[model samples]
Target chain A: MKRKISLNPVTRLEGHGKIEIFLDQQGNVANAYLQVPELRGFEKFCEGRPAEEMARIMPRICGVCPEAHHLASVKALDALWQVEPPRPAKLLREIMCCAHFIHSHTAHFYVLAAPDFLLGPDADPARRNILGVVGKVGLETGREILKHRRYAQDIQAIIGGKATHPVTGLPGGLSKGITPGEREEILSKGKSCVEFARASLQIFEDAVLQNKRYLDLITGDVYRLESYSMGLVDDSNRLSFYDGNIRVVDQEGREFAKFAPGDYLQHVAERVEEWTYVKFPYLKNVGWRGFTDGKTSGIYRCGPLARINVTEGMATPAAREAYEKMVDTFGGKPIQATLAYHWARLVELLYAAERLVELAEDDAVLDPNVRALPTAEPGEGVGVVEAPRGTLIHHYRADREGMITGVNLIVGTTGNHAAINLSIRRAAEKLIRNGKVSRELLNMVEMVFRAYDPCLACATHSLPGRTPLEIKIYDSRGNLQERLWQ
Target chain B: MAVKKVVIGLGNPILSDDGFGIFAAREVECRLPAGAPVDVVEASLAGLKLLDFLLGYREAVIIDSVKTGSGRVGEIYCFTPEALRETVRLASVHDLNLATTLELGRMLNLPVPEQVTIFAVEVADNTTFGEGCCREVAAAIPQVAEQVLVHLGIESATG
Candidate 1:
């Protein structure tokens, strides 16, 4: 019998997602799909509001990357009014951006990605979490994770105004500057964070890279995606999270395109799929050729792995050294293994931590002058940033009165939508053999999907706390076979 | 001496009825007597993120929106941490669920609250992006808040 298996509420992901696998009559996996929910009408809701309000409202979309939204929105406001922020203000904003990356990437690597690598994907669902990771690693490691997360959060709250939605960004500059006392506190935390990030990478080396089987899982074909990589980089092609020119590299590690944020519409395009509410973002010049991953398909990826592939190297010394070692281990440029995203994320964590320290120690951080008032007529603008998950784009248009008439946001997670689906489909096809289905098998399939660290906060806004996860299986005849709750 | 108790509201204020907690938290703040023994915090996070809000409190109350599917719109349901533990759909999503977060806090030897209470307001809509809640959920905000007040052993300001 040709049967279908539905895994709704794909567990452990930040927002709602589901996967369905269809098996052939021979019982081998035939096809699979990933469906992501939609929050609906964010653009329409932004309409008719004042332009300046976006910086405050945009962060409400996702709890995981609110700082990303806050920074991007304010940058858009800056572009809309044709104003440049002062050096101190830019430093202040970048400091917060660094903290945001450390906070967000730390959570993804520890809470969502590490459990599988540390505890083994086939481990009991109850034990395959941070708790289990703690149990294996020890109490000290758990406290370290919590402590670093707290440090990042504290830095964000200090610069952004609050831990959730920061109120620090103004049109041309920040609302306020930090005091010397605050700088000392932030500098101390930033120094410790650099060490923490270094330890995190070592943890990965000890657990996954040191183990042959785990290393195979990371570099294996089942989790590999040979596609175009997109990221933001500075003049030296160094990975820059806050602001830079958008650069992309093809599967063969060739520079495909590089353009400024204002010209993004010339490079990126979106495709709608019938199965999911989330839109698939692909390279505009390459053209959309469906979910297939190749130089011709136009489907591209952004985020840690893709960012590393697109850039020359890290901006900091420690991260740069680690980055070179990772590239060397993979046999050179453009590591295509999807699971390597976990490794790339750690490299960026260290860079952000080091960057945090650099900014905190700068004399400009304590400058009293922070604002450059906007004087130009506000009409239209686009702002882009490399959020922890991936590249985020915030486009807005307003009238002369500064009232926003329209808005469009291409969030970080959405950039990897096509890649996530392709990875899941490939894993499902390989893992599910003739007439074989078990919890361990399903979890293995999930392990491939989790490598992307997909955050669906942009797509799902529903209260997810109380909904019960249910999985159902049905035969070709449309009769239900079994139902299981996780 | 100030009370070592705090009230925390969790949800996205722009997501239709999901803003119930933020709205109710504001109402609770206004209704409390001058120098009330409790501090009210409105946050839009869950899992380990809540640990920051729960640290140092002897007792804590969490008010958030929920969609049980079986519950009526605007119905205020009092739930223990154990009940939420059973109903958690996304086991490891954005952060740890409340039960796991608290347990982790205790294991980490953090000063997490000893007594925790969760009050969920059944929601009518949570996906739409709007600052205001739907009419039904908005009506229940005051009543659910009153229930929280009663649980906290405070008299209603209406009296």
Candidate 2:
């Protein structure tokens, strides 16, 4: 008899996901499917609005990374208006992005990922949460993460005029310029944040390298890698957070293509399925290939690991050294294991803190003229930004009156949707094939979802109603043998 | 000493009428008596963080955008903390909701104010970018500010 085990509403991640495992005659794992059940219609709704509104409206798509959307929207508007914001405005935007990176990544690592780490692989379901982690691992670390989040939000509030959905960024430039006193205050806060990030990085590194069992859990054989990876790489081939050309590289670190933000649509295309609302973005050159269907065939991964792999080295001096040392210990090639996401995230944190300090102290940042007057010209435009999760793209078409006639948004999570589902299914199959399904195995499958760091809420915000996850198993004769609903 | 009041504005200014809270908060800030102990805060929609600002005050007036079916654009609703506690369940994706944060503040023995009022402005077109407030909501800003001033026991000096 073939049995199908389904994991629905996978917890501890931004959006929702479901995993279905198909078993063979001996109950061995045959295939696994992971599906996200929400659809985002902002692209369709944005068709008739003004191009400038993209900056304002798109940010609300996700409460978590609104700044990313805001920046991308502004950039797209700039492209349409055929103007460039002043250097000071660009620097301030980078500073704001750095702050977002720190806060968002910290939230994921501590509140989301740490529960599984500190609470133990076999922790009781009731006790496997942030509150439970505080009890098990102590309050100091938890408090530190919370403090780090607050400090980062403070940076954003000061710059953007509010913490969550900032208002300072505009199409032509920033709405307000920063005063020297405010700059000094931001620099001071940033200094303390660097110290916090450094300490937290140490904690993560120790967990991965020092603890034997923890290392075993993270480097489990189930974690594997293939397909091409993509991220922002600076002109010098260094990992860049803010502005750079995108680099797509294969698993062996060979650069496949280097393209500008506006040309992303040419290299990437969206593949929609009738069963799920999430759009699977694949390399146009590679064609329709499923995950685990071979590197030459299917869609691949993006975000932190892909970012580090594509770049020659880290941007900051300290971060470059750290990356080199990490690679030396882990032994190169792409860090395929999902748990390595925590490590890659920490590496990015180090670079963000270092870069923020540099940008804060720069004199150009205190320039009085932050924003230029808006001269609206109707045209086509595209803006791309590295959201904390992955690359986010915004494209708009406007008429002479500055009204938008079309809008296309390929969010960060949509880029990782294919790999995320495949990885979850792969992990579930391994656990079920081994023996009875335990809560620990369930947590492991959920961890795979977290590893992608999905923002399902943003990817499908306008999805009309709730669509639950459904899983069905078919026998060799194509007979329905089992069904699970969530 | 007289009860001190603070006003908080929440929402994104760029998101058309989503900036209703900020608009009303600004109006209230301008209308307050020069020496009145009122501080206006522009905050993100994070409920727990908003609770932190509410602590240590005698009273607080929160202005925010709402999409309740009972109200149309420019419509305004006022509710006390007790009444809001009864009706506002937890729906936000943030760590907690406004009621739970207040309850948590009370349980922690934090300096939560005894009087808390919320001004919810009905919003339309929350998604349009770069546009000003909806026509109806834009016209109602001064009126909303006036109502807030009267409720706070401060004279509406501007009008």
Top candidate on lDDT is: 1
* C-alpha TM-scores of all predictions: 0.97, 0.78
Q: Candidates' interface RMSDs, in order?
A: 2.5, 6.8
The superposed Cα distance between candidate 1 and the true structure at residue A156, in angstroms, equals: 1.0
lDDT of 2 by residue, B110-140 (tens): 6888878878777765554433688888887
Error of 1 at A452 (Å): 1.4
Candidate DockQ scores, in order: 0.59, 0.09
Give the lowest summed-lDDT range of ten residues in model 1 chain A: A459-468
TM-score of model 1 relative to the true fold? Answer: 0.97
Question: Model 1's DockQ?
Answer: 0.59
lDDT of 2 by residue, A341-368 (tens): 7778888888888889989999999897
Which docking band does candidate 1 fall into?
A: medium
**Candidate 1 residue runs with Cα over 4 Å from true position:** A459-469, A476-479
